[model samples]
Target: MPKITDQVSDSGIYLLEIVVPDDFYTEIKKYEGRKFPKGFYYYAGSAQKNMRKRLERHLKKNKNIYWHIDYLTSRFNIGKIFYFNNCGKEFECDLVADLIEKFGLIPAAPGFGNSDCNRCDSHLLYSEAPLDYSHFISRYQSIARFIPSSNDTF
Candidate 1:
């Protein structure tokens, strides 16, 4: 397990906890006619360089929507962020797979945030109930640092 840091750094895997207040439908680029239900969602991603900048971009309301997660972040609110610094991209896929295996979470959008990934179904996981971050950490035995939306400086 890697050391979790408070500030986002060069390389790591991150999980964004987002809230969707109402049900809606949107065409997520290639994933057309997808329905986003009203609930909590966990989006996993990895940034090999400029991780802090990437996270800052996600925290912002206005930006160029290049990624699928950007589409959701533009519309929804990210409540929390859990990240493990120095973790590789492969860890991201493992985390997503673990979420599905343990929590039986389904993809909010197929092929979302994982266009470059060939191993995972999707990087975004949906659940009606709030996810237990501590449980996830213990299950994976991986250290993670929490960043609330209120404390996002960048």
Candidate 2:
């Protein structure tokens, strides 16, 4: 299916919601030296002006592994991409914090995709089951949208 988004702003926070298959968890641990259990993960990030470019780059399989998120996105498919467009730059970590505090999400890998963030243990959050995206958005109280697929080109 074609990826859809409601791009109403130039910048805000986003969550790359991905599912790591049970068997692939071992491969990720071996390659990245990080223990990630089989489950859903949410990686919170932000863009100042080029949110589309950033999101597009993240969904591609063929890209140079620059950021920690690149390691996972290069291998696993992002099941969903959530965009919170009305927030400021600081909302990236805020989103992660909310996931942990309200939704009981746990940090998967320390310093994973949050090198500059001191507020979060990791940008990547883990849960055994899928996070209720709509519920989370209702609690978030901000302008948001979600792209249902990641593999398809925009």
Candidate 3:
């Protein structure tokens, strides 16, 4: 298990681990119908204000689906949340790009979670295996933080 730090930031970047159990197709608002296979997914996002509240909303079972991530998290369970304190929004794109370049992780959906981002193909990445957070932390030692779902609280 990874340790949770006591330090908290009002705004920062976060990665959500989502698990889908079977193959299924569903339409997401304006995007094309998406096909989700049984596997794990990682979504990177940023909240520039009230970061803890944003994360808490994601963990809630009942809420209005507002963002692309909301659509997914509303359907599937989020197993973990890895975050970085005081990280700017740009770091969200950087993390996604790094995952693509270094880990060869591809987007599960082309425009998922990046309607506003011009630099990233998508903020959501799919994988057969869980991401190695230790490796990411080793590379970004100064900012990386980990919080498993069991320990996450507002």
Candidate 4:
């Protein structure tokens, strides 16, 4: 597993592996003209100034719903978080495209968490199973390498 050794640069991209258990009832009926089932939801997001704060807000249970991902995070629990420390802005969309093109992962909903990016159909990807973290750590190479953080449940 990857570890967090630096705290200076909080700017980077993150992928949230949110798991809605098989028995869990998903509250979102429809979003952006699409429907999603109970499964693993991967949301790609970036925090240029404060990644820690952005992540904390996402994991918080009682926060207000602002982003598209909040609709789900407010209802379900996040299973894992993977991040690229000190990374640039472009990687947010690149990461989403990687999952769709290389891993064959499909978008959970169109335009979900991708209002600012034109390169992706959505920043959220869905799978019927768990995601393999090794894929990012092993095969991918960016200016700032992707690492699995020690953060768990905020």
Candidate 5:
């Protein structure tokens, strides 16, 4: 199994979080004291079986454009894409949303709700607050970035 590096992105560079089983929290040890850039990032993903294919579609200059992240790709070319595994269908959606909120970066679109976690209403998703990656450290250790895996290339 490949690692899904945890990621962070700005309009210019995208950070990543590696994908690992939800039960495991080993790699996070490596990110201690490392800094992640702060800015608006569209968080979108699916349970599609092919990671490479999904990344290709996401990297495409023209795509179906369904999720908010897809549309944002137009505004800002996706600088980097992070991949995660064990993020099974059941947990992927909620887990992604949870990570976003737990990190404290304003959910790409907060109009959907203050919290991006699946528990909130999924209507009119929009960000009310500005992107503040620094704020995320308040919620969790800045080191957790090492635990997840994401791609920096394409």
Candidate 6:
């Protein structure tokens, strides 16, 4: 399993890529077209099962916001969140992180992580690849399955 880390929020434009199973689409639809308040970082994360449950945790008003997304969401109106159905596993986090970085995005949480994220002593694993962010944007647009058309320019 890859280690997950939290970053110091920079309040930069961020793209959250959440992976969900096909059955979770219904729940994802609830927040479709919803924009999180600005100054707040959008909380984005993935689950191997039960997207609703995981998302619910994020929505909980009383919960402690540990993840970058959670803390950020509390402050900013999530400009938009992209949901990718049928995705599972932690390695994908790295992929999504790379994609987000391709757009020259900065880390909401920059220095926090464990061994899984740091495969080497000198480099962080999540920082390994130059994300093809545009590819994902295009894929979401082409499929039409993703909520809030990418053209909306959130």
What TM-score would candidate 5 get against the native?
Answer: 0.43
The candidate, 1 or 6, that scores higher on TM-score is 1
When 1 and 5 are scored with lDDT, the better candidate is 1
Lowest summed-lDDT stretch of 10 residues in model 6? 1-10
RMSD of 4: 4.1
Question: Which candidate would rank higher by lDDT, 3 or 5?
Answer: 3
Steric clash pairs (candidate 3)? none
- Model 2, total clashes: 0
Preferred candidate (TM-score higher): 3 or 4:
3
What is the alpha-carbon lDDT for the whole of candidate 2? 0.78
Q: Report clash pairs, candidate 4.
A: none
Question: Each candidate's lDDT (Cα)?
Answer: 0.81, 0.78, 0.81, 0.74, 0.37, 0.36
User: How many steric overlaps are in each model, in order?
Assistant: 0, 0, 0, 0, 33, 18
**What ranges in model 4 sit over 4 Å off?**
1-8, 22-34, 141-154
User: What lDDT tens digits, residue by residue, belong to model 2 across residues 11-57?
Assistant: 77888888888744433443365456788988999887878778888
- What global local distance difference test value does model 5 have? 0.37
- Candidate 5 per-residue lDDT over residues 1-154, each given as its tens digit: 1233224221111122212112211122333343323343435444345544555455565777555444444334443333344344444455445555654433333332123445533322223243333454343343323222133322
- lDDT tens per residue, model 3, 36-147: 7878889999999888888878877689978888877878888887888888999999999999899878888888899889998889999888777678779888877777
Per residue, candidate 6 scores C-alpha lDDT tens digits across 35-118 of 332122222344545554454454444667665345433433322344444444443455445545554434433332222344
Q: Which ten residues in a row have the lowest lDDT in candidate 5?
A: 17-26
Question: How far in Å is the alpha carbon of 71 misplaced in model 3?
Answer: 1.3
Model 2, C-alpha of 117: deviation from truth (Å) = 1.2
Return whichever of 2 and 5 wins on lDDT: 2
Q: Model 6, residue 106: what's the lDDT?
A: 41
List pairs with backbone clashes in candidate 2.
Answer: none
Model 3 lDDT, residue 21, Cα: 82
Residues 1-154 of candidate 1 have per-residue lDDT tens digits of 1223446678888999888999878656576676678999999999998888888788788888888888888888888888888998899999898888897787877788898999987898999987876687677565687776664454
